[model samples]
Target: MRGDGARAWLDEGLKLLAEQGAPAVTLERLCERMGMSKGAFYHHFGSMPKFRTRLLAHFEAEYTTAIIDAVEGAGGLTARERLERVVAEAVKDTGPGLEIAMRAWAKQDPEAAAVQERVDATRIGYLRGLCEEAGHATPSRMATLLYLALIGGAHLMPPLPPAEMREMYGVLLPLLD
Candidate 1:
């Protein structure tokens, strides 16, 4: 097994989750993908529950916290500029099948549902901050609409083409300005 067996397991778990949904994220499945044994898996995670908890944490860090950090540290940008950049980046980074898989997993697992709740709150809260900074009359309402437009739009049928989505954001940007 690799030295960072835990990370490797988590990576495989994420891949399985994205490709085959959370039900496929079994220890057996992960070990099979990693070419490792149960012993190796046990060495990294004490139990399946522990592994699931850590996997959710890893997802939150990779998906939500990292994006927030990047947007906050972007230099020489106004609040609107930062918001635009975030929307543009989000349009490009769809997380492939991961978001859909997670949403489905949350429906069945309360633990996953709680994590999803926190992730949504963090993202929406950040948008609200941007709206407040830009002096929107109804920051909360604008933030909700903006977040729904970006996140909800991601799961739309025949998915929104990136160019058209960018155009939509372009139109919305002036409203925030």
Candidate 2:
């Protein structure tokens, strides 16, 4: 396919995936959305698996640079401020159902699982670095626990009121100190 065609397909595919999840990103649907032929799809992606690979790469790049960067940028701030900011930032996905959908898909798809493994490793590494910067011992283990807790809290505590969340952070932050 032409460069413009490839770009259009990828953009449309990602939008469809984010809004409706992976199952909604069928070749037929993409072709219909882009008003293109199946030949165009094959020309760029070769196959659905190839397209999925590209999509994952795009996701990794965007999430790391945007959300993760925002989280890590908290480094110069107090640890408590950092954690609260990270918590709020990580959970603030803009209609990209892809993150949660990808997590669910990881349970059954080896490729998805691999993507998640990379994401986890990156998150742990960031947290570990932060803990070290704070002069904390056992940084790796602490990073793991903190990373897991943040993810768990984000999902499980949906009704987490703002003031209560702040209070919870107040309780946990000193533990890190």
Q: What's the lDDT for candidate 2?
A: 0.70
**Which parts of model 1 are misplaced by more than 4 Å?**
1-3, 94-96
lDDT of 2 at 123: 74
Cα lDDT for residue 88, model 2? 59
Where does candidate 2 clash, by residue pair? none
Candidate with the greatest TM-score versus the true structure: 1
Question: Cα lDDT of model 1 overall?
Answer: 0.84
Measured by C-alpha RMSD in angstroms, how accurate is candidate 2?
Answer: 4.4
Span of 10 residues, lowest total lDDT, candidate 1: 88-97
Alpha carbon lDDT of each predicted model: 0.84, 0.70
Model 1, span 1-177: residue lDDT tens = 343568878877888899899999998888788888888888888999999999999999978898878987888888998898788777774544787889899999999999999998998899999999999999999888887887666678856767777888888878875
Question: For residues 14-43, what per-residue lDDT tens digits would candidate 2 score against the true structure?
Answer: 677766777788988888888788898999
